[model samples]
Structure formats: C-alpha cells, structure tokens
Target: MSTSTGGGVPASRFLFLGTRAGHSIADAEYEAICHYAGLPTSRMDRVRLEEGPMPQIDLDRYAGVITGGSPFNSSDPITEKSVVQQRVEADMSKILDEIVARDMPFLGACYGVGTLGTHQGAVVDRTFGEPPGTGHIELTDAGRADPLCVGLPDKFDAFLGHKEAVRELPSHAVLLATSGPCPVQMFRVKKNLYATQFHPELDSTGLIERLQEYRHAGYFHPDELDRLTREALASEVVHPQQILKNFVEVYA
Candidate 1:
C-alpha cells in the first residue's frame, strides 16, 4: 500500500480499492492492476475493503481510483449478504456518492460495473452473465474515438466472467465497448468515471490464480480447472491491458 508523508499523499500516485477477501487474492489483484497500468507498487496504494471498514478517503491525495472485482453480487438479496459484504457495499456506495458527484477519475473492473452502474441508475442483474473465458469485444464508434480505446483494435478478445452484468446503458453514460453476450462491456459515466465488464488487469497467470482462488466460489466446476488453465495460457490476450495503461496515462 502507498502512503502519505507528513505533507500529504503525492498527486501522481493512484489508489486501487480491492474487494477480494483472501490476502493472496487481494495482493495479486493489486499487483496485476499495477502491472497492467504500468505503475510501480510504490505509485499504487491499495485499500482492501474485505479486511475491515473503509476509512474516509481524501480523493485529492491521488491521481485516480480503481476498484477491482469481488465475489459479492450487487443483485443479491439484502438478507443473503454476509456482514462483511454489507459493510463493504455500504463503504463503496458512500465513496461512490462523492466520486460520481465530483466526476472523479475512477475505473471499475467487473464488479465495479455493477456498483457504478447501479449508482447511475442502470439495471444490473444476472441476465447477461457470462462464464469464465475469453470473449470478443467490439469497440463502438464512440469507443474507437475515445482516448481509453486509442491503441485498441476495433475488435479483440478480453477475459470476462461474471454472474451479473449491466443490462442496459445508463442514460448518462457513453457506450464505449460491446461484446456478444454482454452488450455493455464498457461504459463511461460523465467524463472521468468508467466501468468495464471485463478484467483488464488479468494476464494468463493472474487469471489462473483467480480461477484457483474462486474455484469453489461457483464460477466454474472444480474439474474444469485443467481445461481452463490450458485455454487461458494458450489464449492471446494482450489488448485489454491497454485500457489500464491508457487510464493511467490519461489520469496520471
């Protein structure tokens, strides 16, 4: 985690808000985010929401904010959620209120789509859920012109696996990218707040680690690990990381 000195947090540093529970998963997620964003560990501060209550954040301390995927489903019944999940959601929601209102620079991956989408009045449910695998992403006319999609191909494969999705684009959002199963692959709210249905931070090794961590978490059958690992390693997924890089370049 990055820290502040007696003066204040440096403006060039970025903060990654993580929601995964296990220490290894959380650490790996932060590492992958920094790796893909071309940010050194020293330049990226990590807040692991699963560990405890989130502290009041001073947004001015960092260049931007990024939230990682979580096992907690936004669409889950309130009664079905665990205590930690409820607290984490509340903490995320509180921060989002300020982030969205101020048009803060934020990029949410996978589960972030749900939180940000829900905050913006978009419906997020299990309707367009996709299995764990690589999916085709097509950049929209707007996507092609968007700075975040600058170096990306018109169409490419990205790793995605979620139990819920943004069923429709929020009224105030710009549809940046689309995919076959899940149409709202990426969208921008206001000028700086962004969300993605895919995991841009994931490489083959990272994906393998996540798959193992969540194997019993219901994403896929435990028996499929062998095949998933093979396919994951064989797949060429080099474009999505550009999103992370673009975000960091534009914001930092």
Candidate 2:
C-alpha cells in the first residue's frame, strides 16, 4: 500500500521508497523516517515497491527521495533470491540510474548500501557484515565537511544490522563514515546521492520491532532475541538521525 501525507506542496514532497513485504514493518519504518526527518505524517509520501512495479519518477516533482532498509540483499546468489526480491532490486536499479544520472537528492539507508554499492561497482559481500546492534562510527575528513554530517560529531554511535556490506568504497563515491567491522558505513555518489549502511531512523524501540519480526532471518540466532532486545534498550545511540534531518533540510 502507498500513503500520501497531505501537508506539503507537490513540489516539496519527499518520496520514501520501501521494499518490505510486511505492511506493518514497512509502516513502522516509514513513520520513523518521517519522525527523524522532522516531517509530519502528512508531508512524507511513501511507495511500497514490493507491492508493485516502481512508478515512473519525475525528479522535479519532489524535493528528494529516501529509501529505507529491506530484507533483500544484493549479495545473495541470483538463484537464491525470491522472485519478489529480484524484481525489487531490478526496480531499484532503474530508479538509481535516474537519481545518479541527474544528481538528484537522495538518501538510502541499510539495504541501500547493497543496491547503490552494486550499481556503482563496489563489491558488496559478506566480508564486512555486522551483527545487529549499536555501531561505532568515525567520520572521514570529507565526511566531517559534508553538509549531511553537519551538527554530527566526528565519532558517534548508531544502530545497525545487516548481513552484507560494501567491501570497498565505490569508484565514483566519496567515503563518508566508517566503522571497524564495516569500513564503508556511509558514502556519497556525485554530490546529492547518499547511502548509509546503518539505520538512521531506528532507535531501541525500532530495533526491537525489527528483531521480533526478523528473529529467524539469519541476522542472529533466534535464541539471542531476548538478549539482543535488552542490549538494544541499553544501548546509547544518539547521532545518526541527524543525517536524515540534514538531508531534508538541505534539499527541502
């Protein structure tokens, strides 16, 4: 299902593209995106890509585009991916072609690393996969100066959970943030296209919701759910959402 928030002018609307199969999960993610971006529910619009083909995009119609996490991994063998996953990736590639080619404003979180990295020729594999938990990030010199990094500390904590990660920086991208386990935590393509391996929209509560739904998704052993939940609640993650807020402020 797709949702359109009513307050923003058509030209100022921001599109959130989601690839989740579960409506509840996708809805939660969407709400978080709107929350952190400081957008009222009536202003941020969403498109659930798993529900159908991506509609044609007119970059000029919206101020910017944002995509959130998904269970789909680009590193999964083609033979192993579900038909829906394959279609979603294909659709995402088409949109990326337009976004990248035009240098349109965009921010992609989590699953975005895989899609955007693959499109930019970066090797996204299991080599740097990090477990679901708080991640420690240190900004590169370039990242410190990036407009999106404004008001963010050089080093801060953010919530992250992924099964695959970018093994190296893409040739056309500038490295923005780094973690020991995942060196390519964030990067920018051209000037406006950005992707983060971490979830800027997730907090302890958000992470717990995902853990409950994905307990059996191989992110971790199902038996660890309780402990993971406790850890998530106890974790102090304070700065990543600034990226989302910055994206909206800079572009909108």
For each candidate in turn, give its C-alpha RMSD to the true structure in angstroms: 2.2, 2.9
lDDT of 1 by residue, 133-212 (tens): 89999999999999889899999999988999999776779999998789999999999999999999998898899889
- Residue ranges of candidate 1 with Cα displaced over 4 Å: 1-6
Clashes by residue pair, model 2 = 5-42
For residue 79, give model 2's deviation from the true position in Å: 0.3
In angstroms, the error of model 2 at 127 is 0.3
Please list the C-alpha lDDT of all candidates, in the order they appear.
Answer: 0.90, 0.90
Every model's TM-score:
0.96, 0.95
Task: State the lDDT of candidate 2 residue by residue for 11-124, as single tens digits.
Answer: 767889999889789999999999999998776778899999877655666889999999999999999999899899999998888788889898999988998889889999
Name every residue pair that clashes in candidate 1. none
Model 2, residue 53: distance off in Å is 1.2
